[model samples]
Target: MYHDCTQVLDSDATTYPDDPPVELAPHTTFEKDGYRVTELGFGTHSGTHIDAPSHTEPDGRTLDSFPIETFVFDAVLVDCRGKAAREPIDRTDLPKSTGGDLLVFHTGWDAHWGTDAYFDHPYLSAEAARWCADNGYHVAIDALNVDPTPTEGAGDVSGNAKDKPEGVPAHHALLGTDHLIVENLTNLDGLPEQFTLDAFPLSVSDADGSPVRAVAEFQP
Candidate 1:
């Protein structure tokens, strides 16, 4: 069995405030004596998306350069719900002997999707991203990000006022290592605490990221 990880993009779908919102345009209407056709415009990272290394690394590989095999692999789930903000999940959080190349985090943040709480949610720490990088965990979180708010600061430090003030250390740690970062996943709570995950994105050439259709499967 499989569960879709892709978000249904609509007028209400969440996106980076700086990016242009998703919009649908009709190129040819069925009633206009033509075939049904539509044009979609949105940021690459608009929904349940995968961030390629190039998303953060200037010299990193693009989505088209990624090997097809990279999209298919074994996976392990690490559930860290109820954990403190910006918790660092080291090797201990993972299975003792996971054979899969992919590591997925189930933080139960999907419940807050479409709400302001979702954007303000906590994320994995830089150390957690480092751990995944060092251990060869190909993919990362399904939550907002992997950084926390600044512990000591009166004014916003990061340029983006809407983003967390902790900076993009998580992006640097994970994306810097050429690991794929999947964000804004939902329905992870329905999955078992531990299971196999499969995630794939559209093979868009030269794209920094693309919405993925991720899924988890386990024997009942």
Candidate 2:
């Protein structure tokens, strides 16, 4: 069966404070034009989205640079429930024998989707980021970021890894290695330990990121 792991986008969707406000004005209404069309507008990273390497790296690959096959993969869920704010998920905590190219973190932070609490939820340890890079895994998180949010408490710093005082290094870590990063995911709790993931980003030329309709397929 196929499960929609994507977060439903609407007016109340949570977003980074810096992102543009989402707008869905009617371009044409059935009453006036006998058709329905919307003028959609939002930031590249506005909703459940993917971050390409160019999101941080100066000469990194953009969304259109990678082959479409890179977005679809087998996946394993990493349970991080009850992990504390800014808590780093060490590489040691990851599954020893994961079954796929994607590793998704289920932190249960989607519970706090529209509040300040969501922004400060647990993040991936710097080591975990490097682990994904080293192992060639596509990573997705239910939290606002794979790393810490601005103003959140610092977690365990990786050895000599330059820690950003106001940001987590996961973005730079994954993007720097040409790894993919998906954020603001929801409905991950219903997923099994292993599944099929098809996360395709918009083919926006030269863009750094795009909202994705992430889905999970698995046998029931």
Candidate 3:
């Protein structure tokens, strides 16, 4: 069975501060043209998306740097639910051994999507992120960011000048190397611990990141 783990991108979709929101316009209508086509406009990191190394590292690899097969992963899902708002998921929360190349965290924060509380979802600690990177495990989370997102009036969306770790420590730790990070995943309630993840990003040249249709497959 296959499960869709991607979030829907629409006008009401939650987005990071300053990032562009989803925009749709009718390019052609049945009454105006023979065919109907809609114009789409949004940032690369709009919804369920992958963050390539270039997103944090200026000279790091982008989405176009890897082969298509790289997007497919043998995944392990980590249940980190019931966590407090803006809490950090430490190394202790992660499994030491996993027969997979990817680690997906189910934070249960996707239930708060499109709300201010979603920004306060649980995040991965810098130590945990580095652990994953060192262990050669790609990471994904069912939250807005792998790092803590700033509150509306707390600071900028990048989490500058806040109680949290300065800058994006989780991002730099993981993306600083060759690993990838996927964020804003949804519909992970009943997935098996082990599964196959197919999350292919758009093939954009020198792209920092791109939206992905992340999917999970496993035998019932």
Strongest candidate by TM-score: 3
RMSD of 2: 3.7
lDDT of each: 0.69, 0.83, 0.89
Q: Which candidate ranks first by lDDT, i.e. highest? A: 3
Superior by TM-score: candidate 1 or candidate 3: 3
Candidate 2 lDDT over residue span 1-22, tens digit each: 9888787778778887677877
Q: What's the residue-level lDDT of 18 in candidate 1?
A: 71
Task: Give the winner by lDDT: 1 or 2.
Answer: 2
Give Cα distance to truth, residue 33, candidate 3, Å.
Answer: 1.9
Q: On a 0 to 100 scale, what is the lDDT of residue 19 in model 3? A: 92
**Candidate 1 backbone collisions, by pair:** none
lDDT of 1 by residue, 1-220 (tens): 7776666788788776576788887889879946988789888887788888888799887888887768765777777776544444554665666466777777777776777555555566667678777777766565655555343321233334444454677777878888878887777756665566666778788988887777777776
Count of clashing pairs, candidate 1 = 0
**Error at 71, model 1, angstroms:** 1.1
Global lDDT of model 1: 0.69
Q: Determine which window of 10 residues in candidate 1 has minimal summed lDDT.
A: 149-158
